[model samples]
Each structure stands twice: as structure tokens, then as C-alpha cells.
Target: MPRNQWKPFQSITVQWISLLLVCLVALPVANASEPKATDIVVRAKSKDAKFIGSSMGGAMVRIRDAESGEILAEGLTEGSTGNTDLIMQQPHRRHQSIAEGAAAFRTSLMLSEPVFVTVEVLAPYIKKQARVAAQTQVWLVPGKHLDGEGLVVEIPGLVVDVLSPQTHRYTQMADAPFPIRANVVMMCGCPISEGGLWDGSQMEVAALVKKDGRDFATIPLALEDVNTFGGELQPDGPGLYQLLVYAYDPRTGNTGVDQVSFIVR
Candidate 1:
């Protein structure tokens, strides 16, 4: 994740408290070289939102008019020194400006030989979720048509350690009239090695519910005795139900939630 575009998720409750959500941030970055004279550089390293560093190795930075797509500001490095930095004349005011400059730079490549320029975007926050599924196999009737016994839910955009095994398996007892069992598997991007570092120690699941294309409910769920982050719903006897999984990041107090649907007989 680009530094500027990266952010921890935080939860918020609406006035109705029907659905839960988190903030989303977007950031954008670069390409390679051509004529030293026409080339521009957008720095990737920084502490603040704006690009506030000196340019090195004859590199230059340019800020263009957002609407007209005209060059409004420019900064160029003085020599071949690799460590040198070139600060932009005017700091980028918003994400749109960076996007505009990126577009202009890309356009330049088609007209003339490609001049490699790097562009980056900074935003507020991003959201991510953990994956969920039945840990064990539940009994399914042959052709008698009983409700499906297994449930699987996946969360997208999650970061995992990637070095160790990334599979999780567990089982949950079905509640009430359903009278069966559920197995869940959580596949996280973070590998097993990284799992111990997490505050939750284990990833849990939750549902992001919607109805008729509008937000409706967010339910925390769990398996067996473990509070995986969701609750079981009583079946209406038949039809489809949306199931989701969520991961809580204790470090940033952020939560990621995603969903799928299931049918009950």
C-alpha cells in the first residue's frame, strides 16, 4: 500500500444503527525515464500529506492546472547527486491535482518519447476484512432438500504475513430449530507467523447486510463458543440469507467486513 493511500479502519454507527461502516482512503504512485530535460518526478517518500522533499539526479516535479491541464508549478534538481531532493514550488492542494498531473504526464508519453513521471495520491482511511467459513463439514441430506449445512464467507483487501500457512478451520454449533452444525474457515492474507502479533490473536467474522440495494444491518458472528464477531440468525424456515465475515484490527481499532448469501430449507 502506498504510504499516503494507506490507513487503518475505524468503525462508525449510523443514527439508525442498522449497518456499520469504516472510512476509505485512496492513494496513487510512478513509472521510468526518457529525456532528462522533459522528465518530471513525484516523490514517494514523505511524513506529511504533501510531497515535501528535495529532488535528486536531475529530476524535476511539476504541478499542473487542474481544469486546464496546464503546467502551474515546477521544481527541478540541480545536479547528478542521487541524494539531492527537489521541492515542489507549490504543495499539492488536493488529490484531484495529483490525478490531473498524472494524466498529463501519461499523455505526454504518447506525444513524445515516454518521459517517466511518478504521481502519488493521499487520502484519509481504508477498510479491510477477514475471511470466514464453516470449519467442519455438516451433514447434508441426499435429495430430501434440507438447508445447506456449510457456510463460507470471504473478505477482500486483507493484508497477511504471506510467509506462513494462511488457512483457519473451526466449528460452530447451530442454534435453535435449525438443529445442525456449521464449520468455518478463515483465510487471511497475514500468514500464521503474523497471526500471533495481532491483538485479536485470531480473525473473526461479521456480516454487512443490505436490502433492496440499501444498507440494512451489520451482525457480528461467532463459531461454537468463540465470538468470531457475528451472531446466528433464526431461520424463517426457508429462503436466502446473507452471511458475512469481519476482521477487527486492534492496533488501529479498525474493522473489515464482507458478505455472501445462503439458503435454508
Candidate 2:
């Protein structure tokens, strides 16, 4: 073949190869911008399930089955700030926000069998209500520990109202080894007996008991030794008992007492 005839054919073949190369390289870059449906990350045994962000602004998430696309669970990770960092106790699926309006989905797989959970975080346009802090001032009537099984008191709910502190009172009563009913009392901003020490000249602790809605007896206790606040109930009686505690500190005069009621079996 002549050299001029071969040159023209070679040029045409080279042009065709260059076009094919451009097609292969440009396809991947276009696919990179598309949103992904699945993101799998393997967690260690000790790590907790948490959102990968912090202070997410009203972010919401949902979990779904990968193969079936059935929704399983969901939660909101929006904090006061705009980052979605949260700790989930169980395993599930998660969808996160890529932009303010658009979203990108991600999946989390747990290696630990016990703590398997998936959570989806979403972003809502409107703001949500703020959570209230728990009120420590409202205390159980009888305090924390009890000698018998029936007498126990705890804060009632998850959210304690500050404006209405009285709503948080909760009591637990059950059959006990002994016939005693314990009660709780508190005095704030004033000297109260703690650490087993009380001033002999300062105060007097009093408990007035009533049975069947009738006044029974008033027992006065020396502030120096008034630690236990429970009393033995009559084994034969089936009525309810009421207990009221009053404090008299000479420096602060007489402070009022709180009334608590319990039943006897």
C-alpha cells in the first residue's frame, strides 16, 4: 500500500478512539452527583449507635429494610443547633439531609448482635417545642431508701413541671415484711437534718398521725435523733394512715410540714 493511502485511514481510526475515551471518562463524573440510596458502615462492638453529627436543626430520620424498602423505624436528631448527632439504642435505617431541602439516604449496619438498630434522621422546616428541665425541688415524701418493701417513692414522670412542682409526687406501696408505712418530708432554703447531725437547741421534729380520717396522736421527736420517719401499723386494722411532719427551728421559728397518706393491709 502507498504511504498516503494508509495515513488517511490511520487518522480516522485515531479520531474514533479519542471519542470512545471521552465517553467512558465523562459517564462516571455525571453519576457521582446523583444521590445514593445506601451507605453501610460497620460499627465496632464497643461503639454506641449514634448520629454522625451534632446540634442538627430539627432533623428527622427513618429506618427501612434494604431489600424490601419497608420502613422500620425513625427519629429526629435536631438539637438547638443545626447538626444531627444523637445516640440510638437500637439498630435501624437512616436518611440524612444533604442540603437544606434535599436529602441523601445512608444505612448503618451493626456488627454487635445485641444492639442492632437503625435510625433515620429527617429535617423539618418548622421548629419544635423545647424540652423542660427536671425539677429537683419536688422530692419524694419519704426520701429514697426504705427499710421495708412496701414503702418507696420516686419522681413520677419524665418531665417535671417547674411551675407546678406538686404534680411530680409519686408513691409506691406494697406488702412488706413488717407493718410499717414510710413517708417523705422536705424543707428547702432552711436548715434540715442531714449527715446524722442535728443541733439540740435548734429544732423539734413532730409527726401527727390520723386513722380513718380521725386525728389519733401527735408524736414529738427530738431533732437530734429523728432520722427514721416510718411507724408500725396495727396488724388488725385495715384503715388508711396519714402522716404530717413539722419542723421547729428556734432560729427560723416554726416551719410548716407536709402531709402524706398511705393505706395498711
Candidate 3:
């Protein structure tokens, strides 16, 4: 074959391949990436459980595949780093520009289809490595970002010291619900009424009951005052109980966890 005759054929083949590549790149995440799914995002918010306030930072979040237990993504909710999550940035540019979750966390992951996802959050309330923690499972749809249910964690640097009944190894009436009280401020530095990014009223407070150093149950405590909450432990029978008072500000993703020990006799 003459050189000129072969040139046209070669040019056509190259052009066809270039178009094919562009098409592939333009395809949705599912068809473009392996497993044939879309990219999704997970977000977090912190609220004060003790003072009904909010914290500015100090939260560690983890997203995992419920079935495989694979860690999909993880990050801190410290407001220092702007939330770079595609979900938070998506649907519009203004939303990303003015988004106010300084203590919030956002993580992106890819999936092929709809599946269950588990989100684990740890918020250090007292800087003692003890954290206000919460876990929830959410159904994530392909190509969609899912906002996890709010997780209540302890506010860093805040402690809800149990006041009513001194925490001790002594036993209480097993059949009776023991009274509980604590003094706490959920805000990171200032009071909730300061009227700034760190507010307390937006936080949710929940109580956790653990058995032998393991979580056994949760009781949501009611705020009595600015920084006080009242709740009770009604043990079924005589046993050791570890009660953790927790605060989480979903707005900033800050958390606080406090605990006292008691015995049921």
C-alpha cells in the first residue's frame, strides 16, 4: 500500500481512540471507576452535652463498611482545617464559602451501590484519653452523600464532675434509681451565651452506662441549668456500673465525656 493511502487510516484510528478516552473520563463515577459505584461523603457535627454548648475542635471520626468492616475514611473535626468534603462543597459554591462547621468533619468515599455504613466518633472531653463516643449505622445510596446522625461526645477540656452522689466503689440500692448531678460547661473557651460560633444550646447530651469497662446502655440526660444535667441509674441488680456523661455539639463536631463509678447492691 502507498504511504499516503495508509496515513488516512492511521489518523482515523487515533482520532477514534482520543474520543473514546474522553467519553470514559466523562462517565459517572460508577462506570469510570472500579466496582461501578459513585463517590459519596460523610459529615460530622459536635454538640455540648454538659452545658448545652458547643466546642470548637478535638474530634476524631471514622467511616467504615458495615459488612466488611473496612475503614473507608477518617479525620478530625477540629475547626482549624476547613471542611474539604465534597458533600459540604457540593450543590453550590456559596454553601461551601459560608458553611459554618469549623469543628465539623467531612470524608469522601466511593461505592458501587447502596449499602450500610458505620460511623464511629471519639471526642475527648477531659484530655485524659477518655472520650465521649457514639456510633451509628446509616444506609448510603450510590452517588449520594449521607449525613450521619449526630454523635454525642465529650467536650475537650470540659468535665461534668458528678456532684450529687460521690463516685465510689460503694453500693447503692439495686432496685432504686440513684440520683445524679454534674456541673459542666460545654463551650470550648467561653460560655454558650457568648453568642459566637461556640454555642451550647445546640448540643445534645446523652448518658452512657458501661459494664466492666464496656458500653452496655445509653441514657439521655436532661439539662437542668446552664451547665448542669440530672439523670439516674436504675440498675437491674447488684453490679458495678460505670456511668459516662456525654456532650456533643453537632454544629462544630466537638465532644465531651465524663464518668463516675458506682455499685448496685
Compare the candidates by TM-score and give the number of the best one.
3
Which has the higher TM-score value, candidate number 1 or candidate number 2? 1
Cα-based lDDT at residue 143, candidate 1: 28
lDDT of 3 by residue, 1-265 (tens): 9889999899999999999998887786546344434443333332322211234345567878899999888876655323334323345454233233434555556666677878886654234434556678887765665443234333334445566556776765744777777655543333442233344456677778886677778877666765666787676767778887877667665556667887766
lDDT of 2 by residue, 4-54 (tens): 899989999999999999999998866654433332321111011112122
Candidate 1 on 1-265: residue-level lDDT in tens?
Answer: 6765433322222422434211111111111222222322232212111221122122234444344556534443222111211222344343323321111111121212221222222111121223111111222222222112111111222322111011221222243232212222222222222233332345444555443344546555443332222254544344444444555544444454444554444
Task: Tell me which of candidates 2 and 3 scores higher on TM-score.
Answer: 3
Q: TM-score, each model? A: 0.28, 0.26, 0.39
CA deviation > 4 Å runs, candidate 3: 1-57, 80-101, 147-158, 161-183, 187-265
Candidate-wise lDDT, in order: 0.29, 0.34, 0.58
How accurate locally is residue 140 in candidate 1, as Cα lDDT from 0 to 100?
A: 21
Best by lDDT: 3
Error of 2 at 220 (Å): 3.0
> How high a TM-score does candidate 2 get?
0.26
